[model samples]
Target: MFKTSLDKFTSINRIAVISDSALGFGSPDIIGLADGLCAHFGAKGILVQPDDLNRPLVDINFTADVRSVRLFSDLPTYTRSWRWNFFRLAARAVDEFKPDIVVVVGPNGYGASRALRHRPKLLVYYMLEMATTEPLYADLHKHYGNADIDAYIIPDIERHNIDFGNLHWRKDVDFEGIYLTAPINYPVPIKPRAADDRNGKSIYFGHIHPEETLLDNMLTPQLNDCEIEFFGRIGDADRGVIANRIASTPGKAYRGLQTPEDLADTLPRFNFSLVTWKPEGHIGRFHLPATKLYHSVLAGVPIIAVPNPLNVYFIRKLGIGLLMDGWSRRSFIESIQAAKAMIGSDAYRSMVDRCRVAAEGEFAWSRQVSRCAALVERALEKKWRRLYGPRKSQPALAANG
Candidate 1:
């Protein structure tokens, strides 16, 4: 029931966002969007998220007053206990903040929605991934069935093509509502790339779960083309495996986790950013727009990856990256070697230039938030009309005659 008008409306004054995802691994898109909306409308933003005591905080800007409600300080990550805490804390936040709109982060925020269902606030779901997998699919479908949900926001419009089997979303639900595509926290004053910025390296700057993200033991036997740096943390359970993998690998180096500021600075020094998934993996099932890919593009570095349909489409279309040909060990080496060769070429600068242009033009966070703002306005306008009839216009003066 969302209006698609991009018309300006002053209905949304204050926004309350609850990032129900884990503290460190959460997608920064929702938070970034909220920041942009607040900046655009000069509205107050109250962000409720898990405590960030351990991880380095991401830098963001808000226009008006922003009150952060850090909850479940004792919980390190997503847990069963978080569900209960989210409901209680979110209800308290809404009641206290008295926001005009409440933006819930993911499917986990269903409890928070339930807490505020009786209220008249606009409820928007910022769905991170589109999964038609077994358990998650069922849970997501059920969540979509919630009658109180005003709008559903997916990261990309391309994700709508994913096979959902027999599962379907609510007919009245807003599906083609808002497309974040790939969101990035574009560095303020946009960093410029210099001739000396290419440090002859490729880097991977995200959570480390080699078992799921990387090929089995490929780090050691493969990844031989260029110096590959790993700049993110691994979970405790996988540390032993990851450490052994790094030790066995020749060119691979674990740089550990760096703060957002440090990471942004470090990214510009690299020639390319890594965006890998299993050759015949389930990564395509979720159909997410990779945040790091956009970050690398904005940093003026090409993305190197084995082709997922979405990745291949964007990478080739944007001319910002390369997709490997085959899935075998030899093919993998050949792909990395090709990337290294291109990175060293004079023509590589052209590719880097295209990346920067594409990022600033197509993948801009401002454009995403503008669309989001329109969606919010339309939702609020719907509510306004429902409660207060059609807006009245002034009567015409005396006729010209």
Candidate 2:
């Protein structure tokens, strides 16, 4: 069945993934998706992105042959034409690669539009971030429409509706809800931490913004019994504030940024994973259950999250985590206490079992890759028929032709 399913992807011989972010060492989502596509399709994949850091072109194998094209490092930082220059360079790269499919990640609609000028067989816009404001949404709509992207891959269905529901061109294009899940590289049959060994420590990983304020709340004396570790990037301006908070608090500690492998190994040591956000504004309003949620599950750790709709829905459905009653410091403390109580119980064991089950089953990226392949295949078939009429055999076509 697996081999048969992948047979359809043979027509897609080469794929070009263009993104605004760096490749190989950038967003885990981009890297994971690119890897999954390469593995599933057995295609040569080229990742094109701006050389913001001037990194050398390198090949990082995930499953199939994958290479990076770093462009536009010599342009002046203050120049307004960098975006246009990037689009031109990216289009030239896509033309040279002549990939059967082009998957654009990030908010680089104009770049994707330029790639269209080269006439890729299929153009897909993979939206990794939410359109936080109306102006941004309008801008994305304008550029994406101009790009004439064939499909969209949004992280979550709820997020798709919240972010792109009003998009006028949405119905005209194919779209799929692929959750931002953990890569399949995490070790399987996750050993659940013993109740006694949990040690009341929880974890919060990913980019830390001072505006969230939940970390600061966790430092209060009321929550001292429950230790929490912070990981991932922090801006220079907020570093002092967070460092001081961690220093002053007995149980709170700021561990430096962790690689994905390190994170996978480290997450299981904690009692719980924190997935809370301030319940206001764009982030609070439509925040989806992201990498943190799946990472925690894969590590066999239950999530203690705020009552965001997607988080609440998944937590209740999976039975792998708990949701706080509200987004207050008191509610946060209460949730930690609740998690602490369940630490050594059979209930906690059940939750851990659920996490392991989920990690290997629905939440895994392997399944998502299959879904993605099918979506791309469908888009290709439709495009093939529309462009050249129905055919008995679908042959690979030059994307630039």
Candidate 3:
């Protein structure tokens, strides 16, 4: 029956990707996937989002033919105004592109989904998080439960199809196993490094803020050997704290923002990419993989992350990184010591080779987009068959994740 239904139609030729600038213009990984999807299917891409006008579409890598329709105003503070502006923009984008499939990124797609309620086009919920045991996840499930989306292209595979309390009863939204981590276009060559390379010469390339006690702890004299290079916006409240921390860590430098285009070339110069959450803290509730994970993976740089369920899954699954026991001074020192030993070892070289393989195969944006494209074709065919009965077409196909 599944194959029969999917055989009713052909392929997806056009796609519209909608994102919320309110949520900080989405990550570069998703934007890369969007771009790859357009190229892979030969599909015209129509991107719609809330616009700041002053800045370029931050974190997005769009192609020339991919039309961008940005609402020329700040996202309104008032709830009603926000909804009104979003719906208006969504309507305008639909009118302009008249796309075959609409890809809504994150929660920003809520308004767009409502706007496209009566339209015949298929809506894809390109989700970032999965509703697990957390209350926040339950709320997310409620949102998805109400949205009239046809398919889901979840990035993290481990989070898919898990029971979401009462929300599991709804069978309308099809779970397509299309996933993405980053656009691994090519293998980033790993530079030869000294055995002590992983000592204190690590890189941390994401949001810099207060309450990140791990970074604060790294400033201790006991942790001096492992200086971290920071590259992201520092939180206002933590400005003084970060300045002091950088001052103490002699070799450490806060390089500010680095564009995604330069990350592949820049990151391989560092020993490893740092990733740690507040220990036993509130961050453990959600199951979203940090964007930095993919950035490091794509660049052939291994990750040094505090052991969490999601972090453990990714690092172990790919054999591409090391997981610290905790954020304690002892933990950090021990992990770095282990890193030092691993550098130049055959095992380390193997790990780097594994990362390169994983990047091009499992986490490559082009492959993931191809998988999503196939899902779109199948889902649209199924929907059409249900409404108008089967029509002759090519055989149904599926993609490996």
Better by lDDT, candidate 3 or 1: 1
Candidate 2 lDDT tens digits, 1-401: 45542344337888888876555433556666776787787888987777654334444445567876677567753244666677777888888888888888755534445545567778887877655344644564655563367788877666556555555445566888777674523212234565456656789887676656366567779988777899876645868777777767887789977655566667789989998667556642446555778777877888998888878888899998999888778898888888878878899888888988887788877777777788898888777667666457778787994
In model 2, state the lDDT of residue 13. 84
Q: Which residue window of length 10 is worst by lDDT in model 1?
A: 181-190
Candidate 3 C-alpha lDDT tens digits along 1-401 = 36553453445567788864532322554556566677777878877776554345543346634766666667544355665577667767776677777777755554566566436458777766544445644665576574466778776555554443356645556766544464422222223233234443578876776455366655556656656777766666757677666765765677776655465455777767788657433332344567677767766778887876767887888888899876677787788668756777788877777778877788766676678778877778777776778557988788787
TM-score: the better of candidates 1 and 3: 1
Query: What's each prediction's clash count?
Result: 0, 0, 3
Using all chains and alpha carbons, the TM-scores for the candidates as numbered come to 0.83, 0.84, 0.79
Q: In model 2, state the lDDT of residue 157.
A: 64
Q: How close to the true structure is residue 98 of candidate 1, measured as C-alpha lDDT?
A: 78
Answer with 2 or 3, whichever has the higher lDDT.
Answer: 2
The CA lDDT at 305 in model 3 is 79
Best by lDDT: 2
Task: Report how far residue 237 has shifted in candidate 2, in Å.
Answer: 1.3
lDDT of each: 0.66, 0.71, 0.64
**lDDT ranking of the models:** 2, 1, 3
Give per-residue CA lDDT, model 1, range 1-401, as digits (tens). Answer: 57533232435678888875544333556557667777776888888875544654444544446666666556544455656666677777776887777887765555566666346457887766544434654565555565676776776655544523334544465543443433333324236476346788888887677655664434746565467888877755868777667756878788887755577678888887878655344534435566777778878888887666667877788888887664456666776777788866766888888887887788776677888877877776776566565667889898897
What clash count does candidate 3 reach?
3
